[model samples]
Target chain A: MRIVVLAGGIGGARFLRGLKSAVPDADITVIGNTGDDIHLFGLKVCPDLDTVMYTLGGGINEDQGWGRTDESFTVKEELAAYGVGPTWFGLGDRDFATHIVRTQMLGAGYPLSAVTEALCDRWQPGVRLLPMSDDRVETHIAITEAGTGERRVIHFQEYWVRLRASVDAEAVVPVGAEQAKPAPGVLEAIAAADVIVFPPSNPVVSVGTILAVPGIREAIAAADAPVVGLSPIVGGAPVRGMADKVLAAVGVESTAAAVALHYGTELLDGWLVDTSDADAVAVVEAAGITCRAVPLMMTDPEATAEMARAALDLAEASR
Target chain B: MRIVVLAGGIGGARFLRGLKSAVPDADITVIGNTGDDIHLFGLKVCPDLDTVMYTLGGGINEDQGWGRTDESFTVKEELAAYGVGPTWFGLGDRDFATHIVRTQMLGAGYPLSAVTEALCDRWQPGVRLLPMSDDRVETHIAITEAGTGERRVIHFQEYWVRLRASVDAEAVVPVGAEQAKPAPGVLEAIAAADVIVFPPSNPVVSVGTILAVPGIREAIAAADAPVVGLSPIVGGAPVRGMADKVLAAVGVESTAAAVALHYGTELLDGWLVDTSDADAVAVVEAAGITCRAVPLMMTDPEATAEMARAALDLAEASR
Candidate 1:
């Protein structure tokens, strides 16, 4: 089976790990979300793409689910001593090599897609990892300061990683998504996929930003493959990350059914809500999508593989 | 007293440490050679300038006389694992931070001189360090492959560090020197100096490259200050490094007197030869330059400081 997965950072990476475990023989092509990509210390950092690459290649910090295991922060500490910052963004020595190589390639006139391919040459991440779009697409968050009531726009990382999404997000904008065409193989991958899975990644900035790229959503909507989504939101809250904050920015309720509806009937063919929110399955099915309630919590490898197995079954059922 | 010194890498840095010990109150300005600066992994590696900074700032690896004192090679190892390298260069994790910060600053439009000064803010290397030229002036070595008989030009670093100067250097060319202008304050530092000294650095590549910058040699020649130089060549070979190979490339003999004549009477007022080269003192003085034979071995701090003191005394006598 040829599977297509649109991934974000840790959560999406974790889900893809399960997907790989569930079907080791399957040929997976990942369309990683690059909207979270940021330029730190003049190096292009693709957080989600790296997370997936590191996670699958076994370089990942299994505990944190991102960056390299046994990573040292000597470079970071030295940089801080030099007083060159956004010291808030923690880039370890091992992780720095990835960004440095990517930045160097980009500077040498390679697009992000080519750079991603070149980097993957090292990791052999077991999947053809394609960035959502080769063109720059940064997700920015509009937030109101809690004390000052001042409205300001900041990069998604500052809001998510730095601010911890403490202030209410007024809006989430994928700045260059409207102008960005899908990276070369994205549309073809979707069209050729036996099944496409959205792996409980953030609705607004992760998977949503991937869909926002011009032609990507249209390609998926037109694709014959069943588009199965495992809800990032389970019961009344997110299983991980601050998804509820950005979900509110898009005026979507923090519920399993609501997230499925937000993706909507046109783009989605199958929706899987957690067993805790089993009632959401009927609500999602009422919206003309084939729905299932599964144990969606990716607690362990076996559990996550089961989630992957459930999604594949739903794809078959919906088809 | 205001002093100006033309410097290279390890040898120059070690001499400066002694000069600081010798003249604790002198205002010293260093004109560091940048001809050996090379772009490795897309980051500017200013080897000589960094050597001067790290050595004076108490961060140098004491054994090696370059790089950080306590450094890890995680970044370098990771880069090698990715098979993205000229792995021979060996930039440690701490040193990578310096290059990253410099590359970012330079990319943001800061001139090489300004970037050096800013970097000094962290190192507090005491002496004012300025690159020989703000413009790129890479030194290239012309060599013939022994077995293949193929003549090719390689970077100065490739010739020095990687090849260890194993092959006879056909020619040493400061590629952009003819077009390059002195960095800001370099000429002023020379002109305002009470005394100027050339450390026992690579005369062909280090001090020679600095003088190659269009106006620097002219400024030194026209300056009222007494200009003195310590011979990198002691009796018949260079004190350190492959100065002999490059000296031969320039058609100069690897001897103290020959090197003194290479910098001529117009540019040099005084010359210091090691006690072993006492006979060469007469040979150098015959060329209208005052010469002294001294214990020039920089075995330790006190010994090196005495050498610095002798050079100062010669400068005073010449003046």
Candidate 2:
């Protein structure tokens, strides 16, 4: 079976690991959101892309879920000594090499799609990894300062690393999404997919950014394959990440039913919620999307694969 | 007395250490050549400037004479895994951080001079070290391949690291030198110096490239101070580095007398030759440059300090 997955970082990477284990024979194509990509020390860092690459390549720090295992900070220290800017982000020496290669290739005129393919040549992630688009789509968050009435838009990393999401987000904008075309393989993968699954990833900033690209959401909606979304929220809170904060910016309630309704039955054929939010299933089903309750905690690969199977099963039952 | 010295890499760094020991109270300024600078993995690396900084700041590898001590290669390994360019040069994880910071600063619109100042703030290399110019002046070598009749201009790193001076250089050019201006404080340091000493560094590539800048050679010749050059070639071999091959490129013989004659007495008031080449002292003196024979081997700090003192004494005697 050909499966297409839209993913973010840690949560998505972990869930995909399980998905791979669950559907061993399925050919998976992942369209990763590059909205969180940041240029630091002249190297382009694609956080979500690297997270997925490392996780699938078996090089990820299982505990941190980001960066490589047994990483060293020698390069970071040297950069600090040189008084380089944006020292707040913890860019490990080993992690830096990935950015270096990606940046070099990008500077050499290769599109992000081609660069990702080149990086993946060595990583050999079982699934094909495609960036949402080759165009620059930066995620910017608008926040009002405590003392001032003026609002400002900050880069996603500034919001995540520096601010630590302390303030209320007025709005979250994917800057270039209006003009970004889906990478060449994105629409085709969605059109040919047997089942399309949205992992328990940040809806507003992660999967939403991927959907915002021109032609991607429309293609997924028109596909003959079943499209199912796993709610990132469980028990009225996000399982991980600051999804609730961003969801508030987009004015979406942090509830399993609300998130399912947000994606809508027009594009989504099935919606899977955590067992903790089993009561929300009736509300989603009433909204015209087939809903199922599953143990959504992706604490291990086995549990995640089961969650993946549940989404696939929900799509089959809906048909 | 204020002193300004022209420097290259390892040998120059070692000599500066001794010069510092010899005159601890003297305000010393080092004008470093940037022709050896290479952009590797999107980071600008000024080898001569770094060698001087690391040596004086007490961060240099005493045994290797370059790079940080106890350095790790995790970054390089990661870079190699990603198949980045220029894997031949030994850029350690700790060393990469320096390049990263420098590249970031350069990308942020800061001139190389200001960037050097910021880097020096952390290193605090007691002596003022300035690159010859903030402009990008890369040294290229014209070499003919054994199998091909065509000659190609290769970056200095390709010649130094990959070829290891195995090929015959048809010509050596310091690109961007024609329009390059002397770095700030370079001319002032030269004009205000009580004595000027050229360390036993590669003459053609290091000191020669520094002089290639528009106003630097003129400033040295016009200065009221006595200009002295210590021969890098002692007993018909370079103290360190591939000086002989470079000398051959410029059609200059690799000998204490030949190098001194190459500089000419019009620019140099005093010339120091190794005691091993005592016979060459008369030949250098005959050219109207004051000549002194001394044991120029920097076997240890004490011996090198004595060499510095001897050069100072010659400057005083000539004045």
Model 1 segments more than 4 A misplaced:
none
Clashing pairs in 2: none
Task: Tell me how far the alpha carbon of residue A99 in candidate 2 is from the true structure, in angstroms, after superposition.
Answer: 0.7
- Residue A240 CA displacement from its true place in model 2, Å: 1.7
Residue B44, model 1, lDDT:
94
- Report the lDDT tens digits of candidate 1 across residue range B206-276: 99999999999999999999999999987798877889999999999999999999999989999999999
lDDT of 2 at A29: 99
B37: Cα error in model 1, Å:
0.1
lDDT of 1: 0.94
- Cα lDDT tens digits, model 2, A230-296, are 9999999999888899999988999999999999987899999999999999999999999989999
Question: RMSDs, each prediction?
Answer: 0.9, 1.8
